[model samples]
Target: MPSLYSAPVYWNEQQYLLSFYDPFTFRLTISLYIAGISLIPSACSAPGCISNYYPDDRVHIFRVPENPPELKQAWIRALHCDNIDRLKVVNVCIKHFREEDVEYIHKVPNGDGTFTSVPRYKLKLKGGAIPCLLPGCPSYYSSTSTSKRARLSYEPKEKEMLNQTIQLLSKI
Candidate 1:
């Protein structure tokens, strides 16, 4: 009544009866399973997009927004024209938040007199803060309640490229 993997006698008997053991297939299957398991943590939980590669500089996966729906809507509006599917995976980069909205972790001395802090500086953004009005990011700036004419209005193009990249990632 033992399982196939738990019963070594069964495996030996099967190998003896077949006179062959496909170790390569077994190992390949095991390695594939392990690799798939390793990717689970990186999988995007966004509704429509299932991307796994979120580059550090370009994509900052903020903590999922609160339940009120205003935060998500604001992010979408700030990022400019949006489809629900694109909004599903919309994440803001550090550029989107005002400097004041983000909290910086300070260096402090530990009890033994050793300074302990993040190896690299990290900023924590508050949950309710909306995306900031960046001067050059047309998507953000124009979306803001500001003047329409921007000398450097290239964010629409950037959004297109970002969309293309996301589409490519999803296909992969």
Candidate 2:
């Protein structure tokens, strides 16, 4: 017995069927599927930012907050993104935030009214934090300084006051 479907016949039939569709569109669709390109968008939302979400990358992506209108506006302005009245599903990467704004430890409360500071494996934004270190943007967008300032000591003032008090007591 002979096979009903032959290879030449099958290929000819496929080519004939494909001729009805636009070649560019069909080839593009097939190539995209074969290339395994993701349909989901996973890039940082900041303007000019090229960071993308990857499992192995140390960079962390954070969702833009929708609540607290002030914070949302601040993030939008700092990022230099416009016309984003609704920031749903928008993500900002860790590169846009200052070192102090990102929290790396979690304070777990103990039953005995004490707290233990446990290091966190994932990064989190501190409360009232804003994204101010936008790279590839105007320098004014990152107006805040990154350098930590040295704290002035009050020990000299305290020592002078103590000496004055001691002298007063001795005279009395």
Candidate 3:
């Protein structure tokens, strides 16, 4: 019949009720409920919508990644290993695709248990084309097949890491 938050009730922050004068049979009822619960979780008293974590103070994602088993984990690893800690993850390119991302990264082992840390620059949405198209380079370089020329041009540090990997591959 009537809501429970129509009167001047202070259940949370930014929440106050407004009631009207009802003089039919001498009974008081609530008119409506309003508040800024959406901004603060602690102020939320709705059914199944309150928790210890505050929505406003949550970890804001600087970037979101595509579907992958280890999306943020991979990027976090990259950030922790080298001097490229300022670049935040704006997007995920997907499994094996991020290798071509413009970020200067090195997939080196952190030696902290069994994880690898890779660091690189922010991924650019365009201008990523494989470079191994030159005459001197063969169609496949030691099994990698192709290398992102853009990676070499834009992120030499990353390219050098790749080169090192290629060198190891060639020896085996």
> Which one wins on lDDT?
2
lDDT of 2: 0.62
lDDT for residue 104 in candidate 3, whole number 0-100: 53
**Candidate 1 global TM-score:** 0.37
Give each model's whole-structure lDDT: 0.45, 0.62, 0.37
- Displacement of the residue 150 alpha carbon in candidate 3, Å: 15
Candidate 2 local lDDT, residue 165: 100
lDDT head-to-head 1 vs 2, winner: 2
lDDT of 1: 0.45
Error of 3 at 114 (Å): 48
Clash count (model 2, backbone only): 0
Each candidate's TM vs. the true structure?
0.37, 0.54, 0.16
- Please, what are the lDDT tens digits per residue for candidate 2 over residues 24-43? 32321111111233333356
Q: Pick the candidate with the highest TM-score.
A: 2
**Residue range 49-144, candidate 3, lDDT tens digits:** 222233233321123333342443333343232432444333222222234434455466666766564764433322332212112223332123
Candidate 1, residues 29-76: lDDT per residue as tens digits? 111123224322233333333333332313334544655564555555
Candidate 1, residue 115: the lDDT equals 87
